[model samples]
Target: MSMSGDPVLERVRAIEDDFADAMSRMYTVGNELATLRARLETEASPAQWTPVAEPAAPPTPAAATAAPQPSPVPTAPAGLVTPPPPAHAPAYAPAAVPPPARPLPPAEPWWQRDGVVAKILAVVGATITLIGVAFLLALAIQMGFFGPVARVTSGALLAMGLVGAAALVRRREAGTVGALGLAATGIATAYLDVLAVTRIYDWVPLAGGMVIAGLIALGGVLLARAWDSQLLAVVAVLGVALMAPFVGLDHARLTGAFLLVLTIATWPAQVGRRWWALELARVVPTGLFLAALALAQERTAVPVVLALGLAVLVVGTTVAGTRSERLPLQLGALVPVGVMPVWSAGVAAPDRWVGTALLVVATCLLLLAAGLVVHREGTAPQHRVPEIALAAAGVTSLTAAPRAVDGGSLAIVAIVGVALVWAVAALVLRQRSVLLVAWGLGVIALLGSLALLPYVVLRSQAGDVGPRHLVTAVLLVALLVVTARASDRIIPATAPVLSRALLALAVVSTGGAVVVSGVLLGQLLDDPRGGFTAGQAGATVVWMAAAALLLLRGLRGSTIAVPAGLTLAAASVVKLLLFDLAFLGGLARVVSFIVAGLLLLGMGAGYAQALERSRREGTDRTPPGPPPGPVDNPTAPTPIPPTV
Candidate 1:
């Protein structure tokens, strides 16, 4: 290509050739460097040991004067005698000097490094200190050594002393175990004191006590930040959690509010630090508190409102705080947001309005996730973290849809609509995440229909169905049709198997719909037994018709359609012979068998004619060849006649 004499192309090709040569040289040099380093190490080790047969020692000053110096080379000038090599120099040829080896740091044991031991000791010491203080106070109280005021005053003094001691210790040895342990003990003691003030003595009300405890926890958080210790921050968060029960054992609302406030206070601690443990410390207690409230059969409205606020705060902070690379935190943060709808559906009374509200919540969550995906992509242009988060939120929220709705049929209808919406969105946007959500929602709808769909039509025939029943059947049928038709477009080109499965489902759903409609029509005319029999008979004809259509499609050169058509045709024959023959009677029975037989006969005849026409067309496309014979070549010489 470069030989075409284009100067610019020739120059580009020359540059590419130069680049290839340079890369080859680079690899060769790297291998040489490694070999030289290994040789240097091997030679240096032998040089350090004394030789078995040592060379003669150097001459002394007196012997050097006595010894005769070596004569210069005969070719050299008389005044220019060559200097001798050093006694220590090797006899072999000189080589290039190896680069200085980099010095490595001395290794240390794991427990001895990174203050691991200190952290362990600090955690253990804090636990022991708190437990010891509890036992001493209990013993003193049991022995009647101190009154209520004395006990409260003593606890306050002890907490203050511990805090002061922590400050002094940290001033001397900043970030040491002693300071951390003392600080954790002080914060916990302060929290316990507040709890005692609220619960044991009722000196301060629950609200005031909680406020004071929150302040102390905040102080501990500030200290942890100043000291730059994750453990201290975790301890601060856990302090408040540990004291929750004592402060509001019987007060669910107060306990929830306290935990909510604690979560808010700890939100800032997670700001540059991605402290997952600290996050879990706050989340776990709130989860447990909500669980307790639910199990107690208490009025959970207040607590639920508070939990939602906490969830919102955590989710918003997590999204706003991190980038796409930090998706685990973002996904973990979504747990509560995902659980809220389900929790609401489970705890709230079954009502249409409640169901609608929960569905709205789920929708909003999906929308929020979508917005995050767009915003993150537009701003940062990163990997598929946002899409993953979107998928997760979609799955959780969609799972809750059935539970959120009032009834199974309504739920199926709602999910089918969602599936259709996502499917169309996938068709429009062509996002893999959107396509996956569509696929997942379809499966959800199918599963929901497993039990409810059959009953839906049955109830409708019983005159118990309303608009919901008709809407469900219509939406479900529409969903199946739309998904199947657009599967190749919406599904990725790599997933041919999934695309085929959707098509199969479409066939099954369409046939079932036709048969169900027949039964429904007969039922409307006040014929149950006859309607069922006729429905089966009608189904056989419909299946045959579908098979014929598929076969026609196959004739247009579709490999998939051919097998599918054949399978459907086989299924139709089976249904006609077994089901229709066993169930139908009167004109329905006679007409079903005869119509099916005629359709099958026509299909077979059409198939044979199609093959014949295809072969005829192929034959006409090529003219008949002449009979094989030896022929004289146009360029053959007259000598060929002599040879013959």
Candidate 2:
């Protein structure tokens, strides 16, 4: 590569070339040797006749005296001969051979190599061109440079021309950035042109203009579908969505209608495509527009209907698809649908009737979830959709129950009842996620239910415990127990952490239920002398009794029961010593001590008996002797051995 060639450099180049030739000759000689060996082996096969051994005759004197002639030197084949280094070349030690070259890295993917840059540039260029067209239309209108008809005609003609250009470009280069970009821009331009005709020029009525706009949006969707381009579909939807407010001109009804029309127009694109971006483009704008309408406190019949219809359409399309989609996609589709009803009930209507309607909607969603569970057939996690539906149903019920009921206590009871229903449904369906949803709802409702119960059971009066409180507590206890059982069935034992947590919840709920029932019993008894203290003492007795039962179960060979029994026993002791000793007095205190002592004594006696029985059984199962073996006293046994 060096042009200013020194003599040493030239000599080095000559040496390199000579080395290359030598290596080539060495390889060629090796190959020739291999070929000759193969040919020799083929000719000397076992099938060929070989001479037998024979006795040798006496050697002649001349033959013995003559020395063996020198063997001739073998020459290499003509082309394989390696040339010697030139005499003029400097004599030097041999250089170390260089390492082999490293292979090149893999090439970037084609889309990353060029397509991304092209798409970005095309979309930006299209946006800029649309902005320019808008400015031109505005300038023409401001300057009165042309009459209304001429302006409308020019804009419409320009939009049509762009659409034609899109078709031509697509025909030439389908699925390219230029085609998608052009189609999106043209569709947006046509919508804008239609808007101008209806609003600015008054050449078309609002109704006619809306119809034309919807058709334009629908046409864009159809073109995207034909092209099979998600990017174009999303762009087209977004383009129309961005311009929807301009068409509606701040009229809430018109805006909601336009949004509803857009959603309907874009619905077909999402049928089986799983085009999440396109779905988001359709849903987000519609949801946001409706939210704005709700905030403005406009008459919301249109918004409410649109929200409900959109939710049903989304769920139906997603669930009806034959292909398995991801759980996140299914859940994402439901999120907007779930949140929209709050505004409808609270701000738009603010009436019990609307709340009742929401309850009905919740019931319907639950029914759909049940139907999905019944009809679905696959190993896939289709159950997750129903799980999410149950969660949404829980939220809807919680929101509606307060409005539907007259009293706070009744509302709390209703929420707890709803949670219990979800838990039961989950148990029936045998789905883990549904079970988790049930537990989550139950826990939340339980927190609300805590307000209905007296915080300190022993401090409350007899009147504090009501049927509603007792019912709510009972429902919560059942809900937790059901969900815990469901978790055991639906969740694999491999997930030890979740299983343990559910078990803990079940145990806690059981203990709480005992205390609650004791408190309620004392209230029902209407003790004339300090029923509260009596109730506290009774709770301690119940605790000790529950602990004894757990210990007995543990004694019967249940591994999990041992630790639980120990923990409950310790808690019972602590409550009896610290709480009952300080709170109870008179006969109540004496009775509590006596009962706790008896329970402890019985538990200990039962445990000891169980251990003794186990040891006895183990002894009975063992052989009477260690086996027939060597005598323990070997020397003493010699007397008997003599007889043998």
Predicted structure with the largest TM-score when compared to the true one: 1
Residue pairs with backbone atoms closer than 3 Å in model 2 (clashes): none
User: What is the C-alpha lDDT profile of model 2 across 1-644, one tens digit per residue?
Assistant: 76646898657555554544455455465545544554565476534322222212323323322432232212233334223445432112223445668999999886788578888888898889999987887898799887778877887787788777878887775446787787777787787778778777788877788778777877878888888888878877887787777777656677677777787667766755657778778877877776666555555466666666655665665455423443223333354353464435343455567646755674575547535533345535533465556666666666666666744668888888878887897889886666767778877886886774353344544456566766776677677667766777787672456655655555555555555555666666765236556656776776777677777787778787778777878887898889889877999899989988988898889889988998899888967776877768546544554543
Per-prediction TM-score? 0.72, 0.71
Note the Cα lDDT for every prediction shown. Answer: 0.67, 0.66
lDDT accuracy of residue 309 in candidate 1: 68
Query: Highest lDDT among the candidates is held by which one?
Result: 1
Residue 280's lDDT in candidate 1: 75
Task: Evaluate model 1: give its lDDT.
Answer: 0.67
Candidate 1 per-residue lDDT, tens place, 308-346, comes to 565466556555545444433443444454345334444
